[model samples]
Target: MKSLFKIIIITVIFTSINSCKYYNFTGAKPIDADTFQVNYFQNNADLIEPGIERIFTLELQDIIQNQTSLNLVPQGGDLLYEGEIVDYRITPMTATADQRAAQNRLSITVLVRFSNKNKEEDDFEKRFSHFHDYPANEQMIGARLTAGLDEIYARITQDIFTESVAKW
Candidate 1:
């Protein structure tokens, strides 16, 4: 019985180790290189919100910094991301019998230019967008606005991270 127990334990341990050999402990698998830089994202939308660009820029930096092991630099780094906010608008999503808006959708679109110094082929310029919907009667101020923006920002940042480093 003792010998049988030892054999079982050894097999289980070996199986687990072999299964995880190619798996990255971190959720993200950064490229072979290190160091990354994100330039301040500029708002290029016609109806620009006063501080949207700043908020977005900071959020992206925070997510990337937390997820990856790369160092953030000011100038060129092994990886670079720069972009502009291209669109910010609210559109009526649904209308009631009175022809009034029942729901409004707030959408934001960002264009990103990414470059990998080590691998030019991996570089890409793409657009990422997200939105949130709220009742048209509700004024999009205070907590309402904050919640809407937070939801959009979270999705956008995740998409950006997946494209830039996570390789998802």
Candidate 2:
């Protein structure tokens, strides 16, 4: 009885392994890009931060590496992503009907144009926006605004990843 149980277990294990589904991902489809090239995202807007370009480059590289099987190469990729920061602004949001400023909102927007070099098609082209709210702080408001911008950048990066790597 014990030997029969052992045989059954071995058979089950081998069957499961053999029946594992395999996915054939060729670069022919619009969503199945084998390689990607990310250019340095520039800030063309009047409002600029010192390290925004670097932040975007690093974030994009990290996302592509983690999310997809696509090869991250320095040049000559199947897909190309290039864009710029189009807008950055801050506005006050009112909590009361009287329009008294209760919080400040920092917003950032980026325009991404993605293309499949191998298939000769535009994969995605759109603008992504992200924002953050900070309560009114009289002291060091600039610092708060900068922190808000950082948060906005992080959100923007995530959106870009979802569109590019996640293929959504």
Candidate 3:
């Protein structure tokens, strides 16, 4: 009798926990979306950041795959995401008094399109971008610039994922 009572109590607790649902934290009601598709982002710009296309594609994929319970599909997914890297530039933001060198800022912009097949939501077309600054004195500017661009891409991808998956 005692063992049976303990089992019943445990089952009740587990059932209550699983049944509880909230609109916050997870944000929005649990969507029925189960599959997603992401296309390669084209780079049709004069100024190019090497590997920018690959970075954006994979980061966007990673964010959606990790954040939500969405299965990534090659074709005919419940949700579709596609976009392009519209701009990539490295410009001197500031110069030292000597004018020899100073600081540089690297910025990138990506235009994203999101669509849900069954829902009548906005189906947003959004541009997400990020920039990073570094002193000219830093050695191996090429490597640092690459790293900076990667960080920016990560941030931009995160923003996109938060909006599309988290519904925030």
lDDT of 1 by residue, 11-129 (tens): 99999888654445556764766888889999999877788899899899888888877888998788999999999998999999999999999999999999999988889999999
Model 2 over residues 32-52: C-alpha lDDT tens digits? 567888888898877776776
At residue 167, candidate 3 shows an lDDT of 69
Cα deviation of 52, candidate 1, in Å: 0.7
Ranking by lDDT: 1, 3, 2
Which lDDT tens digits does candidate 3 get at residues 1-168?
A: 999999999999988776544343445445668899999999865797567798789888887777666799999988889989998877787888888568887788889999988784848899998998888777425789678967898899888877776666
TM-score of each: 0.86, 0.71, 0.80
RMSD of each: 2.5, 5.0, 3.8
Show the lowest summed lDDT stretch of 10 residues, model 2. 21-30
CA lDDT, every prediction?
Answer: 0.89, 0.72, 0.80
| Top candidate (lDDT) | 1
For candidate 2, the TM-score is: 0.71
Residue 16, candidate 3: C-alpha displacement in angstroms: 6.9
Q: Residue 49: error of model 1 in Å?
A: 0.8
